[model samples]
Target chain A: MPVKSLKKYVGVPRDVVANFHGKQVVYVSWDQHLLFAAPLMLCLPPQTTFRELVDGPLAALIAPDPDAAAVDWSTVQWLKANQPWVPDFDRSLADNGIVHKDQLRLSTPGLNSLRPAA
Target chain B: MDMKTEKKTLNLKERYRLLTRDLGWEPSYRSADEVFPYVKYEGIKVHDWGKWEDPFRLTMDAYWKYQAEKERKFYAIVDAHAQNNGHLNITDARYLSALKLFLQAISPGEYAAGKGFARVGREFPGVGTQVACQMQALDEIRHAQTQIHALSNYNKYYDGFHAFADARDRIWYTSVARSFFDDAMSAGPFEFMIAIGFSFEYVLTNLLFVPFMSGAAYNGDMATVTFGFSAQSDEARHMTLGLECIKFMLEQDPDNLPIVQGWIDKWFWRGFRVLGLVSTMMDYMLPKRVMSWREAWEIYGVENGGALFRDLARYGVRPPKGWDDAEKAIDHMSHQIMLGLYQWSFGTSFHSWIPSDDDMEWLAKKYPTTFDKYYRPRWNHIKKLAAAGTPFKNFGLAKLCQCCQLPVVFTEPDDPTLLCNRETVYEGEKYHFCSDGCQQVFENEPEKYVQAWLPMPQLFQMFDGDVAAWMDWVSLRDGHDNGDYDGSRDQQNFQQWRGLATSNQ
Candidate 1:
């Protein structure tokens, strides 16, 4: 359903749509630590959520490595990265809100909070 | 009674409405979509053309009057600077390389923006959008002319300023700017606005303009400083347009958000990649630096960009995909790009110099995280080679990124020593990227980027593997225009000119 929204909204060709839907790629950024991670060759289904992306692909790639010392997985909060501005993350990649190649960053919940204090 | 005395003057808002909004006419025969076909393909759903706002309220009469006054003052300064031999007043002749880079790489981009805005001005359906774009179109052309006029005095004495249009099209380094504008021009009007207006002007213009203008003032190049200020006034309006365009598209339809967001992700990376040259120029090229590229990025990009994104939170937009990577790049991009340019100066139009011990010390202080550990050793090695009269340079052709078209010189994120090269096999051909950011860009539109015009591969093929033949093909005067600035004609001429001025005094 969200794939249809993506196709209708962006007007991407069916083949490109199929490629986006079939592939599992999410661009991840942690702004606080200046860490970015994206899978070059890996493919995940279109319906992958921010939680799944971080818990699955990101944690596997970053948590076990000594080089990812800056990325503390326990404190990570996901924010949907867009252009001109960024907004709070509240949806899956396949949701009508998220498009292919859309960027998401892992931050501490309060570090760079987009939500306003009441 | 005279006709001027008989006429009554209209207020600013009334005149603007009369000039822009009241001038629009619906197509009699052709449908709206038929008349404006380009906006549809980009999938930006603009329900009402009237929603597009002209923030400057700049009607043509006011536009011309304002521009003319600015031009008159700008040219007067240019004339004064030329008559006074302003080139000799600079901190060093080496400072002119930044101007040379600006002329060859950046001024041509302004021309490209002029052409792009002209096309989009006609193509967008809204009269307000059209008028705004047309004004910007003229502004961009004025920027190009002013920059060239400001720098032409130096051209009389320098080597690289000539044949910039040709060199920009053919040179490997200048291709970064060329391809960026070409990309924006080729896109639909909405995408073009998002690419240039939003990402470049709104988000990144300060990073490019502020430092260069201040650097010019600091180095006693008043002509360049004047031109920079002149263009910067116009840039404010352009930045407003960028912000308004993004908000207009997002507010129009829920569906439009994704399409606009996708563009933001793409163009932010593209613009950041192009700023590699600017980063190097700010940090390394200027004899008296205005600010370190790291400090500028933190102020203009990280701090300001973070604030901007927070404002857009309700619209569900976030920072660009490469936000973190771009921030990290402030530490290392200048050193990497400078090293690449220094090693390949013989093939370029501008001169290159090894960093003085003081310069290296400045770099280490600015880039505390990575400079001393990773990059300092390399510069020290190059210094050692220079002392031994070898002065290392890579004569071989480097494999360039398929997306950015830059040499694959970026380092791995974790290990700063290894080159951060990523390759993807698409349609049976291997595509290379300088980093994950660039690789992600290519993966987004493989069909579009597969057709990139990489100059190095083309030159290598054209010259049949001879770099000297390639140099001849590109018309770079090897000994005179290219190589070390220490003993170059430009340097010697500056020294002699200063000596003459001193003796005369």
Candidate 2:
């Protein structure tokens, strides 16, 4: 059954892109790493280039993992909306079609802390 | 058979009738529909509200007498505990971390349950359900009070216990539980019954109460154990009420089968997520372990809950949609949640630490297949970090599931190596979920969930992205109430006091 209420329950979404005060809220996760505990919620400029995110905030976030730096950036498969999508390093997040609350999953091959190679 | 003499000789059934059903009057000024406006519109067809049964048959006077007796006994123990220095009687200062978590998260939930029950009592057209709800509301408040009084014994000598009242409203982690109650509170009355009564109280209450109470007993916490004993009686009535509500709803009309099924599905998942905290408490928080979280889930969740669902099958109800996933999760969630809590301990009301060598051994033995392979290395890494003087702290806010309000810390059911990252685009805005269960809850009712007052958005947009302002608003004192437990005041002081109690040193 639909929600039974006196008034139509129309609510303004709390995390709309416009609510972020000019910063785009992008969630980045290293797919196999449980060490990070959760996908980091980052506030960055929508106009910020994909390369800048990977090299700047993303670098510092993953720097704690020893094997993270060794994984070649180009080989790191990116998942958006649960499907793989290659990002142009030169393109801005907005230009690359990443929106607010988008969980960009980084499935780094060979950097598996959960199932380490014997 | 004089009337005056007959009144004093009233039986249980007679006393119940006089106090409950006899008290409600037929309103001449307003129709019953107007008086009980919320009884409908959720599409539950109750042919007779009178079908709702109160098996306990307890009268208000009897309830008061019983509760007063329990209260007298409960507080006497609490006062004695304080006078005799019962805080020093605990296993260790680390044990207080579990107590601090209980106060900050679970106690306020009891208070919320009281308010929810009272509202439903008024809305249910039947006097039987109304009386049951009324008694439950009182039970909930009493529980909240006794729990506070029990844990307050620690507040005098503990760091994390100081700011729990304010922390319930404003803290990030407390929202895991706080939002669970808020979700139930915002729903209609019948939904409230299924959410709290059947699912939380009947289905999952053991996973919550038993482990903690036993952990309290094992840890030599007499006050908490007494509080547990006091509340266990009330829990029986609650479980009965929940079962009755489910049976009443289903047996009322065939149309209610699907509706009740949906609610069972929703609440069971919701209750499971909230109990992740308890699972962590059982596994990681208690200094003296009662049982592993996985074992408790097998006993309480899988066995007990499985039997309950089997009985519910006659009503066409299956186990929760999240059951299989939860079975997988029980092995992993405590480790994941503790990892998150430890990393974010700086933001919490309780201190978290790297486990002792004994604790790790216990974890390994308890979770043989998963622990050493998946979790031990991460703990080892943190141990190394602490050794090097930089204890691993995640200084950034974690993205939370919009529905459960928990940090998206859980992994995929099929693949524990990969994060169970699920999302949906509704009305041009994106919403994220940690699992299929939470995602389905949102998809079923996007209108209700979009209004979620998520903490990250509140922190960034409302608090101007200042962690200090956020902490100030939540009343968490930096470096005192939170962070690593090894060298903290709670650790040092407990060792000092307990030593003094033991010897001249």
Candidate 3:
């Protein structure tokens, strides 16, 4: 649920991927026109470098969970075909899993207007 | 020590020499003019082809690695920001409106330039232009891609970005850019290089890029600023190529003088018309802070282009034809266009607000002619509405310029009265333009403008249900200003990143 909420906050209206079930993808929309979409597959244990993410055929993992190989790989294939993008499809998968190093603390004082009472 | 090494070095140059000059046999089938007819029609005589020198000396390997690295660095920024939720504390959601205009109006042009430059590379076989065209082509592609990539984050929250790529091809104001570049492409190679490369890139790129980037930085738009500056670094090199090409043509032959001058005149004005959008962006779009359009133009256009033109005059070259129109234009184009955007941008992009009292005062002083006399009246009227707590009306259509394809209603050169009344008739249908240069563009090709499907029409189409339902769209198509940037999701993300950075320290 937190991951799903994070997607909405990053500017991806959930309706876009209502059926995008393969993995959690975090998208950052800038300038109201450009969209950068990256999947969140394996979360890092936290405090990882750029290299640890590519441990194996990371592309294959997103390809078809093998259990779901009957599903279309065309979308994943197209993404891999255009890899090394400015969104860094490779590193994004690792970074998404970062375990929070800090405890969460927040209040609704600033956001009460945007949300109702919990 | 090297008897073998000396022999090998000599052998390499000989082989290259053989391939470049000695290997070519005089054409057995066709005469030179028959083969190179297009270059001659432009009236530029090239006494020496070898005089063309590419300063960057880019080979394939170095170019790809550097370009790829640039993309890597840019993507890393995107990733880091995404993990942390940067830009959650924006002053207001209204700021994204500027970005909406940037995406809808500018990104498609980048792609169009890429396509146009690719064709130029194919058509023009000369190495100098080919290399320049290739770099420009690549630069435009990166611009388009980076723009889309950066803005994608906004799509999760906004409404204006949807159908922007489609709108660029069909929209009315967009025709201003499409027609301008198409004119360059259809013209001779030298004219294409000068009009687009020199006139647009060198003359006004700083004016366009600087404010947009500065506003990005000021507003906490780090990703947008990163992408803009990265493209700008490449633009510096492109500007060098543009300047070099112009100097080369001027020095090549005395007879080449008039043709080059005419192109300079025509393109400078053509390019100037497209900048009307930028003028409005500078003066009105930036929320947190920015230099006004009048100030930027004075420093960049007047000071820079003014100096460059003066230097060119030593070679007997005059300022581009219709320069006076731009001189007149800089006075009031921003004020007028911002007024138009004020009425139209609601519910679609970021909202437009009246200029602050200080900003208006600055405009009055900077644009001594039009501000106090012409625009101040309109601003005062809008201020009255603001005071009444009444919202501005939705949708307005400014009188379109016949030549530049921009809206009319610009103030007179020094008068600010006549409302910049200029018109042209082709096939008996009268067309209006903000300035003479726009009129020339339309007269040059009326068929193009007649077909423009400007924004006013497109908005009507959207309202008429031709487009996807608004506020019911999916991710990446959500558009700008979902109203979350101010301190919700973005705030949470920022605090998290800061905490992580601090804790890691």
Top-scoring candidate (DockQ): 2
Provide the global lDDT of candidate 1 against the true structure.
0.77
Looking at model 3, give its docking quality level: incorrect
Model 1, residue pairs in steric clash: A24-A43, A24-A44, A82-B318, A85-B318, A86-B317, A86-B318, A86-B319, A87-B317, A87-B318
Q: Model 2: per-residue lDDT, tens digit, B278-395?
A: 9889999898999999888889987898899899899898888888899888789999999999998988989899998999999999999888888998899889888988778887
Model 3 residue B472 CA deviation in Å: 13
Judge the docking of candidate 1 as incorrect, acceptable, medium or high: incorrect
Error of 2 at B185 (Å): 0.7
**1 against 2, candidate with superior lDDT:** 2
lDDT of 1 by residue, B337-390 (tens): 888788778888999898888998999898887777666666776677678787
Q: Model 1, residue B450: displacement in angstroms?
A: 1.0
- lDDT accuracy of residue B474 in candidate 1: 73
Which TM-score value belongs to model 1?
0.80
Error of 3 at B190 (Å): 2.7
Evaluated at residue B328, the lDDT of candidate 1 is 67
What's the C-alpha lDDT at position B117 in model 2?
100
Tens digits of per-residue lDDT for model 1, A68-98: 4455555555555323333323456577355
The TM-score-based order of candidates, best leading, equals 2, 1, 3
* Model 2 regions lying over 4 Å from their true place: B1-7
Note the chain A TM-score of all models in turn: 0.48, 0.90, 0.20
Candidate 3 lDDT tens digits, B1-505? 5354434433433543443453233556897666555666556788876676667656545567778888998988877766655545344444666787788777777777787777766555456667667877988899899988887776664455656665465545566676676666655667777877788788878877888888888888777887986787788878888888888888889887887786787778877778888887776666676777877887888899899999888777999877776876676678767766554433233346677788788777767766776566556655665567654442223334434555454555765433444545445444445565666655654554554443333333343322334323312232232322223333344456556755874
